[model samples]
Target: MKGNAELLARTDMIVAAGGGERDVAVDAAILTNKPKSANPEAFLNERLMSDLRPTLFLAQLSNLLAGNISIVHGVTGSSRTFMGEEAAGVDAVRVALARIEAGQSELALVGGSHNGEREDLLLLYDAGGHMLHAPFQPVWERRSGMVLGSLGAFLVLEARGHAEARNAKPLARLARVLSERSARPPGAVSAALTRMWQTLTPHGARAGMAVISGATGAQPATNEERAWLKSLAEVPVRATGSRVGHGLEPQFSMNIALATLALGREKLFPPADSSGVEREYEGPLERVAVTAVGHWRGEGMALVEAVT
Candidate 1:
């Protein structure tokens, strides 16, 4: 078989191992930044001021879980600082993962929300690929436009044994989560593509499949980025930006929602249907990749992949 063909077969195997075509329920619920009011200022004040304190919210949510939960938040600018003193995008995620590994916390709330100029967020299976802070790029700096939005998400994870112990409903079982860094330059289109390639590659380079989504825009390097992705082996690639729009916080939540829905229904939700993007490339995009251009204010560019 050709290299691309071998890659595709490996992808199919990975997807199959991840409970492919299996539907699972969300034992609990995931709430985004949905407060009482939709008004911008009021919502901002509530989220930033008192209504939803990051640590408090995380702890409170953790209490609701049966066992271990991984919470992931993607933020930009001022809000990033407010969440934690960590200076990297994946710092919060790493903290959650470490806590889980150490048995420090059974349920972990990991996620971020940022509001500032030039905001972006992304979630990947592996913490190593996450860019907590965007690197300084001359071209990106020259473009003056940054509007921070409010977006946050939390997940409740329970180990199979723990869930059975509590007699809690099994919504979904996390089959496998992998994180890897690419040799490509930081914040470059190639970097994003490389990460995606690594993400969808099946376990042991065997048969597997995956569904991918994220923000794709008309920004600089967008075309080149798409071109490179198109040249990859045949696999399904879906863009989520059409429905949710662009931003780090919301994208994280939206991607989680998509993943949950996929697991529950055993199907892939096309970007065109969700985000309203007309152009979509599907088929053998087995090695799926998602790229987020531009800085993440205080937290840099973040590229994430979640395959099940």
Candidate 2:
């Protein structure tokens, strides 16, 4: 969805994205034809100069999406793009929310996009042993690796009074959002989550509360998050990667959207994993804690509560 025209015109945007798709056909052609040329170096240079169009090069710029959104949708406000694997997504929302709280901005659009169906992208992850080659499995059930999914997501975050001024209906209220980064030693992730949780809910977990997790089904991160989640004993946990697969840069925003939806409907969706990690919750949902433990680097959490 493009969004409301009135809101779009003034909404600041923060996008978290990775590089663009490569020209696989051109790459294959150059590899095949270059070796055949008598002057291989000259031929390779010529193909690169001709085949790599300026438009194609421009597409690789992470901020290009923000510019295109502005041009197409008339959202001409200040724009920014962040580009660290999963942390980019967390920080994108963090900065947007911070600006709103500080009165620097009244409304903002925050999120990211990912294209997982690319040969170069797959090769890059596969080389690092971060991809799942076998049949697909839910995030919590997987012993190691992740399945990449292509997706784009965005959320309109507006100050409460600003939204009320326009008579706009609110979804869930964002209580607090926190992020942390560590060297990721054995227990670093678990510790980071513990601190963020304490900061978000100083009074402790409440009834009708649930968790929407962004666990990527990758190694130590998943295991650590699973362990930390156990501390929230009765809170129902749902890992969306089981249903949508992992879309890295947009994972945090996607999970936050899901949390808002659940709070809006006053019900959590059925658990996607059979492993004891995800359990069905039939109670009226009131609050949700969204967790993002990056497969490689960052840790963040947000507490969202139903608007009474």
Residue range 163-239, candidate 2, lDDT tens digits: 89988889989888889998898999999999998898888956888999999988899999999998888989999
> Candidate 2 has which clashing residue pairs, if any?
none
- Best candidate, lDDT-wise? 2
Please give, for residues 107-204, the per-residue lDDT of candidate 1 as tens digits. 44344433223211222211323222333222212122222233444444443455467565654443333233333354455555555455545342
**Residue 253 local lDDT, model 1:** 32
Worst 10 residues of 1 by lDDT: 12-21
Q: For each candidate, what is the lDDT?
A: 0.35, 0.89
- Give the per-residue Cα lDDT of candidate 2 at 122: 83
Q: Which window of ten consecutive residues has the lowest lDDT sum in model 2? A: 1-10
TM-score of each: 0.45, 0.95
TM-score, model 1 to reference: 0.45
Give lDDT: candidate 1, residue 118.
24
